[model samples]
Target: MSSAAPVPGRFTFVLHSHLPWLAHHGRWPVGEEWLYQSWAASYLPVAEVLRTLAAEGRTDLLSLGITPVLAAQLDDPHCLSGMHHWLGNWQLRADEAAASGNVALGRHEHRLAAHALADFEQRWRHGGSPVWRELIDGGAIELLGGPLAHPFQPLLDPRLREYQLREGLADAQHRWGHTPAGIWAPECGFTPGMETGYAAAGVTHFMVDGPALRGDTTLGRPVWDSDVVAFGRDLHVSYRVWSPKSGYPGQGAYRDFHHYDHATGLKPSRVTGKNVAGPDKAPYDPELAAAAVRRDVADFVATVRQRLIDEHDRTGRPALVVAAFDTELFGHWWHEGPQWLEQVLRELPKAGITVGTLEGARADGYVGEPVELADSSWGSGKDWRVWAGDQVQDLVTLNAEVVQLALDTLDKLPRGGERDRAADQLLREAVLTVSSDWAFMVSKDSAAGYARDRAHQHAHAVREIAAALGTGSVAKARELAAGWCLADGLFPALDARRLRRCRDEHTSTVPTGHTSAVPS
Candidate 1:
């Protein structure tokens, strides 16, 4: 075979790993189960893939974003125990399916479940910090962090935004001994002038959607004259793997993510045909799916190659192609996803394409001219509608009211003696209330009831604690705050005292005409 010429640009795959705080929350349909499933199906395998690559001496392979709230859950004692149990149960369930005569499905699941169980027992028992830190230390991946609780920063109070981001960076340092210079901004949400806040927080780079850069995504751009850079996701490249209309995961040969064997709690069917009903779909054939993964891997490699060549021809320089997605989209949502990811990574180099992390991209000079980026998100309409839409008006109002109350109450409380559990818990509830997941779920109608209930629960906690303090029921306030802490405890480094009025507050305002406010 002839040796192919080198590809003209670099490629970065970013995976944003996040889930709303779910400890002590209900299970089954939507709660701790969400966490456990993603942990087993996505995190375990994905990290293993990275470890395998690192052993081969690969470095700067990708950018991995783990939000503070998710990190907290991963390292939480309660979550660790729960995950252990979940892995064992998964193995047991697979065995049950085998005993019930679905031999193929049973064997498939059993092998997977057993591997997951052993992986969890040996590597993950201590918690996620060490698992992730290993990758960071190996220089296999760059860790990206976001604000506490993954709140939608654009809709949040400026002071609260600043506080959350600072504490988030500190939390990363506390966990992995390194503060990330880049972030996968929650929801990729941004309002104008947020870059200045990012600069103040010492962030050097962040990601946004393709449209946020007006389709010019060949390189990272400095935002509004700040030293901070904004890397725009290349939709053309990203959508090849997963998009609204078509994607590799939807291929008929791949396992059906939605079709489940209820008794075994395992998916048993393949896509077979898009119109095929669950029961009518063919049984999942690993061999067939593996073949599809190979085909799709070739397709994606070719797609990236052409895109890079086209970009180089246009820009007269080596370009950057970024394809980012939620980490859970791997084994959790697409059974063949991990397989596809591994093959793609291995094949890219042989195919003459270069792979590197976002940090490496910036450091290697893959940056472009400065631009004044406006309000944008990777959400619906490429704006903040998913978080601040009319459909979530009540939630928007609720977040506003609760956050103001929490701030005012914290402001009145004494500052800087020690970490006040009551004040910390109050702020925790407030932060949880504004998580972008709640509104996104509500807008997408994925789990609207659960989303609304969670938002209200956190809002209620904030109100009760503040009211107790106002009524001089100091004991009552502590009790209420302590109770909420049982569930909303994630960021231990958060200091409510620091959230008090700042003499020079970092406002997120960016002058007139730049307001990308959600439609009223």
Candidate 2:
């Protein structure tokens, strides 16, 4: 008897690459190390995996979100040079290891170190690897764009929100050679009215966590008031790969993320035999870890395949399993992540799974019904507590105060050249005030001091501009603008006249709680 062929369903993966604007800034806790580590462990290695897949003609459908701020830093001359130097240093470290007595460590080190250096030089030496272009060109990956600096959308003043979205899209177009159809809303921070902004900017779809779908984690669907589609991450399939407690990385064979030697500053052992400390760790062996990677990839593929089969059986439609993750989690946190990714992509296709991007899935009619979305983000508790928590409460309050001040000042300015300049500065200040990085840093407790400093710096700029306008100090206003120009160098497309017009048109209709002083 002949057997029936297995039906294919949609399986999509979205990787969001984000790092704050950290160029020419270095101070340990939250500085240049963040960029270097991600480059070494994540970007360069991940690029290689995607490139390998494309070369094999197995360009699996994947969506990648590289935030504009991260793009700028990646393309910066200083960052490129620093990465080159770091890659060379890694080669030297590998050579030293090879000369040591440890044969297994030496073998793996020599191979990976050489591979990483060659990959970095060939792909990312100048500006950035054309990896993004190659992926898009080869149909291996779809690029999802985001705001210029990855600011939280809901908390930002509405006037500045448009500027952030517009400039962010413009930057992506300038760098990547095309405007994106989708966005990874910085931190998945979505609000009801933000849809109008996305619609105006031409973003047809964006992502949110599974919980944001009113607990219905299915395919992409439109929001209530707007035509734009929203896709929710499938937490069920995703957590299996990397959950807080039960992830593959926490397995005994994986390299320990927390216990790198401070003196050598390199990870020298695996988390072999759970509860064992780093100093007492077993010898490092890539072969053992590769076995673990194979097992994890199998688990992930089975999870995806089974989920799709179940959903297809239930709905009688090709169901989608959308898996989302931070790009850093691969190389930076889970050393075998790049390996696992390669294996998963290769194995899934052979298993009768149709790997696809968000856009392709939507185009194939994988959309569902619309619903009203509540305030949500993909943080620790799947809420806004990260941004509005006690750690950064003071900065949050200060941000609110300065935003209100800027709005108030814009309200009083006369419609002339001076008013125009003031409006531009007010918009700049307002957007910078709502950057999610500050609150995130504080909440993670990685660099609370730096976060507080950035918040205050932007707040000071807003206050200075407001003070200059209040006293009619045009010279001081120019000085403050020049000073603030150091950090808040975004929104070159911002037109003060439009803001002035918005203020003039909306003054009478301003809501009681809304800040109308700043033009939207």
Candidate 3:
């Protein structure tokens, strides 16, 4: 008999889909433009691929985490308008390019751009309609929820954390007709007390990075103090697809993200030479890229198949490999990402890998011994330096001060008419203060200045409320609350009573030892 090991019982793909709320707000390098681009390049296209697979009767399993912020934009009337206009603009641009170029170049550009626009509108634009519902109904996609604004939970005030979680769940229910069973945890930023919040919110599972499991790479399992389960992304298998240095997207044959032409502001070429100048780009051929995609898919599937066999041989249990990545990396960052994804899903099952969603693995009886998760985030270096780095020191300090101010103000307020309003306002300001955007922007160095400004803006609101409470300036407090409400639009269901309850509950249950907020 051949000595080949049995195939893995399951595999999971978790795609975390998020973009900041950017309808009428910031644009260009940092705001709504980011939203539209991701919609065009990633969200719309990814959804189409899943839908196509389902149409073909291939329900290859996947879990998708669409942040509440993105959901809000998706269902918002204003954003719908903006996105439609943006698509029309893209079509116009393609038309202009086709008219101006040599026949061969022009025709190719026109066909590709028109195909993209048509596909986006046909699949994703219907409101509360069937795009997401089709996937959910079909068993192809498991929806994962996250906080309203994607806050870093470990650093948030206890009360505000509950508000963020509860409101996020509620919003998901409002949009999708069901509560999300799992959350993406807004950057995979998990801390010890977060399980309590997840438990309170009725979330049964969440995604955490593999390093959080110490060296044990497992799939869906439980964590300390939480009846809720945690699924760790299997980095060994995932890194092969998109590691920092050697991901499939970085291959010389793929489309280059960094070398787009500034004048046309469009990517016109394949990644020719690593050292080639930006403007001196070569042409992109979908046929050539398709060949590369097939090779990468074969390599990736082989890696997963081998890793599962190796783990089973060593552990005497059916092994699981959970591959997680940012949803945007698919189409926005890598032009052929959607194509690769479709091919990989179609190919893997034939290789004897049972594709599974996180929930599917759990349902099949994968469970872990309870363990305390170290503070962690899946960022550069897989540590807290991104959130607490020197670049964002001032914003971090401001966040801490604002959180304290909001908490102290809530503590001082009596339970009743005016005091209730004041507490709610403080809670809103506090939740906005803890948004992960500021720290993320600073860490990426993409828009550090804008992030700093936003943090200070929210902090100023918190301070204004604190000052009003201290001086007993009731009228001023109400006015500031009204003004701040416009900018801090998250957590619409925030309740001050919940904040008070969490504080009272936690006061008597403090851990014996304290760990640094920054995970080692």
Give the lowest summed-lDDT range of ten residues in model 1: 506-515
Quote the lDDT for 257 in model 3: 85
Clash totals in order: 0, 2, 0
Residues 1-520, model 2: lDDT tens digits: 3322455578999999998766555636567778988988998888888888788886646899998878877877777887778777766766666666555665676677778778777777766626687787788888899876788777666665665787788777877687888999998987677787899889999999989886556678788778899999998999998876788888988988877645435677998867797789987678889999999898898888899888888877778889999999999999999889888887887777888899898888889887787678888677777876667678667766776787677767776553355557666766666678889888898777887877787788888888898899878887778666655554455555555555543332212332221122
lDDT of 1 by residue, 1-520 (tens): 5536898889999999999999898897999999999999999999999999999999988999999999999999999999999988988899899899999989999999989999998999999999999999999999999898898888788888888999999999999999999999999988877999999999999999999999999999999979899999999999999998889899999999998899988898999998899999999999999989999999999999999999999999999999999999999898889988998898888888999999999999999999888899999889878887889989988888888788778777765677777888898899999898999999999989999999999999999999998888889999998888877777877778778746147443312353455665
The per-residue C-alpha lDDT of model 3 at residue 236 equals 89
Best by the lDDT measure: 1
* 1 or 2, greater by TM-score: 1
Better of 2 and 3 by TM-score: 3
Question: Clashes in model 1: which pairs?
Answer: none
Question: What does the lDDT read for residue 4 in candidate 3?
Answer: 37
Reference-based lDDT, each prediction: 0.90, 0.77, 0.76
Give the lDDT of residue 454 in candidate 1: 95
Candidate 3 Cα misplacement greater than 4 A, ranges: 1-6, 102-109, 119-123, 126-130, 410-426, 465-503, 506-520
lDDT of 1 at 195: 94
